[model samples]
Target: MTGDERTTTVGQLPTPDRDRARLPATLTRVVWLLWALSLVVLGLRWWRGEGWELAGVVAVDGLTVVLWAAVTFFGGIVHSYARRYMAGSETIDRFFGRVFAFTLVVLVLVAAESLVLFWLAWLAMGLLMADLIGHVEGWPQARAAGALARRHFLASSALLGVALATLWWETGATTVSGVAATVDGASPLVVLVAAGALVVAAMVQSALLPFHTWLLSSMTAPTPASALMHAGFVNAGGILLVRFAPVVTVEPAVMLAVVLVGAASALGGKLLKTVQTDIKGTLGCSTVGQMGFMLMQAGLGFFAAAITHLILHGFYKAYQFLSSGSRVEHTAPNGTSDGGTTGPVGGAVVVLTAIAGGALFAALTGKGTALDTGLLLAGLVVLTVMHAAREVVRQSDVPAAVRYGAVPLVALPAIAVYATVYGAIEGLLVGLPAVDEHAALTPVHALVGVAFLLTYLAVDTGVYRRSRRLYVALLNAGQPARETLLTDTEDYNEY
Candidate 1:
């Protein structure tokens, strides 16, 4: 039942006291009503001969409303269904409530992105949404949960809204050049203003250093909230950076500055991840690292590469957070599990489909950008394989279906497809006469990749050499891995 442990009995989280949990219910209804109204407006606009393209976009925007409804309604329903099973457990109720709150925030975001122009407003509104939901669900533990939610809501919303608005207003004034920026012939003042806005945004999102403290502190919230932060909110830093790329991309110096900052965050996350003892802290550091990669790709003018990495890594990390408790159990009980029903064959099918889709897209685009795409994809494959290998070694008792076959089976093919495509693209790009930026991928690039790979390999080997008990201890140590500090909330007893 504790926050630190990884196992739970059947029907652990469920809904109860619905009549008393009126605030979340009221908020849910309000959101649904807004969604319904938005749909009707979009429908009427389409009927009035707004361009079909615009209408289509409206429908896509409706997706956010639907996502919100699904998460909230279904979570509530699930709680109701399990009420009897969870008869007396406020812990489980609060847990599900936190999840519902996180889902509410995500829905607001995706919905806002669909509308494009309303993003600042969405960011603003989403701040209070989680706290309101937490207040409702955490009725039993109302004081502590509500206090945390309020602080989180106020701080995040204020920072996000102000930073984004500042960027939009200042950057809105100028024209730039290059792949990322649209404004051209920007003045020094403009550049300085834009840079200031970005630094503020970076600070707000906890890009690195000081901003990172918020993320670590958020671990005190519910498990699902922790998962949401690691998987989505934390990842927003890289996404926001890319979103602002238009302003930052003009100056090579600025681009390098952004990349250097991203590189630092990545290295910090990696080093800290090595020492993390708590599961949430481990995941949090990993997220910081992933965001760093996204920012790096954006700085490289490989926008699509960054998006690809973000989508794939975000889903997997989220799944990991949601499934952490399941992992401790070591076996599927009943039919309920956090992982998808996808068995080994299903996993293979998913991987193959992804590869095939990538090939198809490359063929269609045929615009020579595929080479960058292929390299990014190849790097993803390398990272994925290494991660699976690490897990296989750490959790040696995973299901035979996954442990022996699925991991290697899915990973090896992905690696092969990515490597082959990357190598072919590189050879073509390099061997072709009169290609621009040919010197970009010189021996230096190769040396850097090799050096990074070797460093990671050494770290992996060291972990493998240690006994499981020692490995577990190292994993538990978290950020200050070398120094074993004791915290009452952390579960040192289990390890």
Candidate 2:
């Protein structure tokens, strides 16, 4: 049985024969009362002016009520379930104790938020949210299960707290400009040094050679922790590079360095993933490669591409963790091969994708570049195909036509607006004497032309095929030389 199966079984065992022990009806009433109070608070917040101070207070107090309600409801369920499945001298008290501690932590978070420490508030939310999910369904305990859960949960929270605190302190001392000013006010030099440190740190955490062990050590963490790391935290390193894009662009040396690290991580990460047998291990390395892509985009000033990659990868990684049961359930070797199935609509993504591809082709070749009015027709085509195909692939009740067509159409206007703004900015920055509006359109045309070419190459034979094959090879290797270095280092040190 998988770890998940074992836990579920422990939670699911029927309540053993026992004299009817009924909890007071008053307790149930109180739980309902708290839930009602929370809703009322939420309504009042909406009714009142959205003042930051008032809203913050309402949010804090309201969330407290909500947390209390959640604890009462879920805590009761866990107690009964534990009583049924977990047999030992250690039963009811331990479960309540841990639950109580968790509730207290929630209370502390509320108070912190009231103080306007938004960053701390976010960190606390993330940590508590993970723990709540992990312990909501109580499992049987062989020995001190409650204690074990507390220790691990608290340790995870502590780690999160420390990391965030360090970040807050480090980022607090100096603004990006201040850092730059230190090196003769040269933004390039500042970005070079700062981004260099971030790149090194990111490489280490991403499990690049000589630092791959952390990924394995991290696997022992709960699945939620793993998910957060994969989806966001691990990518923070690369994201940091993007966040500093304004500075990096001015710093030629830094941009080149970013390119090198991104290339190496992308190559090395894919190779290492291929060799990793553990599910989470594979995820860690995959993140390394994904992060590399984002870093490369940053280096190349492709902010839109980096943002797109980040959002998509985040959801995908999180869904993978939540659905796969995180090595807890024993079914498939690779998590993807088993676990929860998406509804039927998920199965039809391929058809929708083909439609999208066709639309993309039409848009690129259509006449009148610069919003290319014909592309609207092309997008419509893509939308139609997606609508037809989404019937089987999308589980939403919303009409696939409305859903698929709406977002891209909205995006078109936004992209055009941004493009216009970009053109104006270029005109201002580089005053080409007597350059008319039509002449100013040159940059936009050139950019679109380049993008069109690259898109074609990505789909075309030769280069695209080689890139995919290389990506696959690297993903399988688990890091080209990291494994060998680890083994050799271990052997030599033992002597």
Candidate 3:
């Protein structure tokens, strides 16, 4: 902030004038107080162990309680952190206000039972996020980023409207539950359109492929705003899917399409992350990948698993974004030459541990016990465990015996924790129709599964680095708008 604070300048560009900057302590306290109140509501809801409806426009259920708790928890953390982080900046009060408003709108969004409130809340959330993105008043790049984001958000909001309206017209039901209940007998064309619209809306909200540039260019937002967006805001997509699971699950083709979209983004996000040159960009791309997996879980007919991923991802990304500035020391790689690369024996051990991890997950959660989409989920667990176990064995500065033994010791506990959380969330979402809805795995799924595996292997092997075309495509795909980057320095001596 230079010159008059009311018209703070960035490189000689003065934005519209604003009121004097004020401390954000009061707003931060208010958000925390709201979080506390939400927790109290959650406790009462928990004790009651059932949901209620109000005039068919607002519904409070297990999903609502848990989601509200998660939203407010993340909101409280971001607000507290921002109180000190943005204390001295000009326009800090508005930043806090937008953030608070965004949080409240999200609370409204999840509990909304009718199409009108749902759509309105969705649009309001996006507009608030756009304001937060453009909080740096005088930076042209920041303003451009915010506008770009607003366009994408508006598109998402529009699609959501189309989805809800089509469902309403087809089923003659204005409320979410009513739509779900009557959707079975609706025309297939209407179902297809509504489901497609819903999935695309989720993709846009979560920053999936072809709709991710906004997030990539959103570095203009303050780190705290980034944290809030990455942590709680992006999860809107998954929440939308879980809320409308019945609609999307109506057609096998739609579910397959959802799986395909998610796999593409999951793999593409990893590719994009590899090409990133900065910490925030890397984290943003990582969120994209994580969201893809969450959507994939939902498409696989395990809405509980998606919610679990969404909640865990919120906690992780919030911490990653808030603490991104404090990075680890740069040092040479660890471990001996033999341990660095996997030998046959080490590979065998890792693979075995991963399979065992999957089996344990199945036993604990009753998922993947049959030949359905759940089996694919179990495969994902195996893949995840295999990746982690391999890394653990490869990085340990110990003898082969201990390293191999450590795979099961560490991987099994992690799998147990994940299963425990999944079970708990499934319990919380007991009344939801799609909590553990399992469908038969079809040929389309098989094709996608194979492609997903191949993409993973290719990325894991540095194939992108070797193939110039592939690398260039991914690089170009992930780049933000040219205007978002500073190209020249201004010389102030003339002034």
| lDDT top scorer | 3
Q: After superposition, how far is residue 213 of candidate 2 from its true place, in Å?
A: 4.1
lDDT per residue (tens digit) for residues 1-495 in model 1? 244445524453454576635544554455456456655644554354331223312223222332333334433433343334334554544544544555555554543432233344335434533443243342333333344434544565555455444444554521111212424544656655665556445544543643454455445344445445555555555545544555556556665555556655665567567766557777777777777766665555554445445555655676677667665645446865223234455445445544544443344434224444234434434544554544453443456445545555655565555445433323322211212221123343344345446546556545533567655653443332121223433333221
The segments of candidate 1 whose C-alpha lies over 4 angstroms from its true place after superposition are: 1-15, 21-182, 199-210, 328-377, 390-408, 412-451, 463-495
lDDT of each: 0.47, 0.42, 0.85
Off by over 4 Å in 2: 1-173, 176-184, 187-191, 205-213, 275-278, 326-495
| RMSD of each candidate relative to the true structure | 10.3, 13.3, 4.6
Q: On residues 1-495, what C-alpha lDDT tens digit does candidate 3 reach at each position?
A: 132334424473333233433336666677778778878878877788887789778998888988888998998899889866775566777888899899899999999998899999999999899888878876788898999999999999999999999998888899888887899999999999999999999999999988889999898899999999999888999999999988999998888888888888888898889888779989989988989999988888889999999999999999999998887557676863534777889889988998999999999999889777878888888888887788777865778898998889989998999999999888888877655666678887777778767766676555758888888997898888887865534312111
Best by TM-score: 3
lDDT of 2 by residue, 1-495 (tens): 124323222233344334222232223344445556655654554355221224333233322332333333433333333343333323333333443444334334433322234334334534443343233233222112223333443443444334333333444423322222233344343335554555554455344443444444444333544554465444444433433344445555565555556645654555566556656667777777667655654554444344445545666776676555435556555654212232444434534464544445444433123453233223433443443343333435565556446544544444444334333323221221111111122243344334434533343212545576665654545432232122333222221
TM, every model: 0.57, 0.41, 0.90
TM-score-based ranking, best first? 3, 1, 2
lDDT of 1 at 322: 66
lDDT of 1 at 242: 46
Model 2 poorest 10 in a row by lDDT:
431-440
Candidate 3 runs further than 4 Å off: 1-23, 328-339, 396-406, 488-495
